[model samples]
Target: MYLKLLPFFPGRVCTIQDPLAAAVSFDGTVSTVSDTSCSYSAVQDGYSYNPDSYVYVDFDAHPTVSGFVDRTEHVFKDTGADPVTCPADDIQGCSFGPVTDKPKEINDVGTLALTTQLGSLTFNAILGVNQITTLYTDDTLLIFAPVSKFDELGGLCGEYNGDPADDLTIRDETVTTDAAAFVTDWKTDPNCVSTPARSMLRYHDQTSLCSGVPQETVSGFEGMCQDIISPHMNITDLAKDECLQILCICNDRDIGACEASLEEWFTTLGIVDQRKKDPLDLAIELQSAFL
Candidate 1:
């Protein structure tokens, strides 16, 4: 699933695609920036109050991302978003930017690298055959997975097994068209209320329960808040309706949150914006932000 979707609805659990091709599950919990916070108990339990903005990716698989293999998990928190210190044993595993060590591209073992951008994460897949790029800004996390893993993965992003007919595979390996059931099964924390009282938050209601208000009025760079989807893509009304729940329970529902969410959505959906160009393409051209 796109990390950008996480902050949209509180308490919704999803298993997202990890940079190392593994599935990592997490729940959209409270928003440190909003008053109508959900999953406060879970936050007290030390879970992230804002799950998608900054995260700690627990690579449950091979842990092949270099510098982190020795450690059980690696934190992907952008330095500008949240300053963190690596464990003494795995200091090298923390690749905070602006990284002066590695080049843009290399065939060496995978490494969790952060870009110079204030809030972003970068890492090359094993053998440099794939690249996983993520940016966390404006309270949104945008993920761009490498096409090389096509047909070999499954999760909220859908089963990439080359069959769109079965894109709704749930946690139990069963396929279901019910979106609620799909989300419930992938929750990392059962204590979270995965299901909200309303299926879709209404915009007409000014109450905190109306998540659509923020989405409809979101602002981006230069006051341009249009979603930039790829020309090849077609967004359904159902899809748009489903996404309205993002702001209702966010911790920080201010302009920054709205802008960040919109920015990442535009980036993930694909298109070149005058304010923010495609990050991956820019990384390649500059030859200074990857590897």
Candidate 2:
């Protein structure tokens, strides 16, 4: 999706896609969240060294389904370290600068809490309902959804609408097997070009690692990770995929690290879920048992 400019705040806009999304501009304006779609905004505090920034949140009863946010974009007057081209300004756009930090992910058990660079965003969930109360924040941007929407949403967070069958739903509402095409379809702006997906082909070794994994190992992990949701594929299937990726990167001697990464994968799967308990607690327990 595209980041739409907010008229109330100059140089500030809300993303129409990723739930854990952020788009920044050079212009001076406070950040906030608008009721458009899956979006977030940040307000820059007057501090120079640590200007506490915060994103506004909505407190609707029938809450919108915003997936977990893991993506951020910043617009700079000029290109700097690791620049990604943007359609608005050919100079620079979609920078992951420290202006906004990643929000800490929670699970779908009880309350909603997402920690951002600026501060914390928290909200209490109503009992037996799919909505949350007004969000209380310290100085951060956070997103949440009802437990009823668990794995029932889509967008930049992946094709996780509770269906493990189709994870690559593009912007045109079509399913694509091609990774580049999938990324391209999510772009709300036509002039914008997707990042160099093809350029990273050389580093991909998961294909080889996918083979020879024990079925019991996969089933066991999947059984323990039932709470986590896989965005692009079935949790069972994703377990295998993550297994391959983890194996590709971690050596045999680094089995503990691999287990830890797997535990992280499980926790991350529920990061966007709006129920309650911290995914890390489950992750820690899973690690203790499996590792």
Candidate 3:
């Protein structure tokens, strides 16, 4: 399954980890999605692009998957060209920033309304949703979003305000209405619609949050069950470790891909542990419900 890079195609598999490092390096739902993020990579505003109508990346010009492309200065950037605004000193490689802002066409596997919203983190950070440079000063581009757009993803970073989710919340979430407006702003932004990386993550985040797989099928819980109910007592030790493992995978932003891994892990565990008299059923059930 090779994703052919287009236009000035850099030929590198668009990765989630780099974008994440530019944003937040924490290990949470968003972080996991960031690390495992890999999209086919596309030039958002390429040939045949329509600002009025929706356009998506495809081997063929008429793609079934719909997403927005970047409409910013470097909106029409090609691997062949330099970033329109980047200075040579700021970026070492090419005129542009080595094609970091992916095109929406490449990562629109999940049916989504592609936009540049960063996710609930942006709203939680209260970084002024509208690409406020002074506030979002990290080297890599900052994607600003709200939980409604991120839906399920918000829960990952948006907890009861005291848990690990709080670590990422730099601002006050008490202002939910403003955060909601941020989500709208990002979605309507022409620039965000152009970049695939930003838009793809936004879509996947919402898709996962909105349409998560059934709890029992998630691999994290399944693996936990296998570990805890194992023939040996040390299984308990292993079960404790799976929380991070599953959650970490979920953070990659590709819910479907992570869910696939979870399903596989669970299938293998179910087969291997079929014979064991599992005392961890209750615990596993609890974890599974959360997934």
* Number of the top-ranking candidate, with TM-score as the measure: 1
Judged by lDDT against the true structure, how good is candidate 3? 0.24
Error of 1 at 184 (Å): 2.6
- Candidate 2 vs candidate 3: the lDDT winner is 2
Off by over 4 Å in 2: 1-144, 147-153, 196-241, 249-291
State how far residue 268 of model 2 sits from its true place (Å). Answer: 6.1
Give the candidate number with the greatest lDDT.
1
Model 2: what TM-score? 0.32
The TM-score, computed over Cα atoms with residue i paired to residue i, of candidate 3 is 0.22
**What lDDT tens digits, residue by residue, belong to model 3 across residues 1-291?**
111100111111111111111111112222222111121112122112222111111111112212211111111122223212322123322222232222222112211111122221110111111111100111222221221322111211222121333323212232232222222222222244322212112211433322354554454545644543453223533332342233333443444443443333333233323313344432232224224
Model 1 stretches with alpha carbons more than 4 Å out:
1-108, 117-130, 161-165, 188-280, 286-291
Model 2: residue 65 alpha-carbon error in angstroms = 34
Q: Could you tell me how far off, in angstroms, the CA of residue 110 lies in candidate 3 after the best superposition? A: 40
**lDDT for predicted candidate 1 compared with the true structure:** 0.31
lDDT of the candidates, in the order given: 0.31, 0.28, 0.24
